[model samples]
Target: MISVYHYMTIAAILFAMGTYGVLTRKNAIVIFMCIELMLNSVNLTFIALSRHLNNMDGQIFVFFVMTVAAAEAAVGLALMISFFRNRESIDVEEIDLLKW
Candidate 1:
């Protein structure tokens, strides 16, 4: 049987990879994907705990997280599309929109 440690370790690795991608990637879409990866990693932890405790609370929380993730993906993709349309490029370094 798989232990909690195994699940947790997998979650940790996924979260780390997502973090690294967010920090190193310049494309907005890639960063968005990484954010989703991080969210999924958290969901994995929640599921692991839920199974270990034989409770529904963790699974319920995962449901909520999934809902939020869906909303975030929709809004993030729309924003990226709008930005790309205006800038004609999606490169993070060149598409600075905060300048005066």
Candidate 2:
């Protein structure tokens, strides 16, 4: 059986990688993927705890979080498409059109 500490370590690593990608990537799609990675890391932690505690609450919460994340992806992608159409670029630096 896998240990809780090991699971936590894996989650931590995934979260850190996601954070780094989000901070360093310039493409909106890549940033979205990083956000999903972070969310999945949290879900992994929740699933691990739920199994360890023999409880359903954590898994249920993860389901809700996944639903929200899906909605967020749809909306965010739509916005990114709109921005790309208007600006002809998806680079984060070129997003300065929003700045006044």
Candidate 3:
């Protein structure tokens, strides 16, 4: 039977993959996606624990996390679009506009 441990394992794997992607990738979009993945993994964990504990708070927290993730994604995409337009590239290493 599937249990909270299974869900937690999946969440852990997803979080690790996201972390690796964030650390190794240079593209702004990929990094953005990795951040989303990490957020999702956390959501999974929250839901799993909520279910295991028969409590509502974790699920409610997941709702808040999702809302924040959505906002973050919208803002991140906007920033990426603006940066791409300005620099003609999305490579993180190539971005120097922020350097004073």
CA lDDT scores, all candidates in order: 0.94, 0.94, 0.94
The prediction achieving the highest TM-score against the true structure is 2
- Ordered from best to worst TM-score, the candidate numbers read 2, 1, 3
Stretches > 4 Å off in candidate 3: 97-100
Superposed on all Cα atoms, the candidates' RMSDs to the truth, in angstroms, are 1.3, 1.2, 1.5
Worst 10 residues of 1 by lDDT: 88-97
> Ten residues in a row with the worst lDDT in model 3?
91-100
Q: Higher-TM-score candidate among 2 and 3?
A: 2
* TM-score on alpha carbons, each prediction: 0.93, 0.94, 0.93
lDDT score for residue 33 of model 2:
98
- Model 1 accuracy (lDDT, Cα): 0.94
Q: Tens-digit lDDT track for model 3 on 64-83?
A: 99999999889889998898
Tell me which residue pairs clash in candidate 1: none
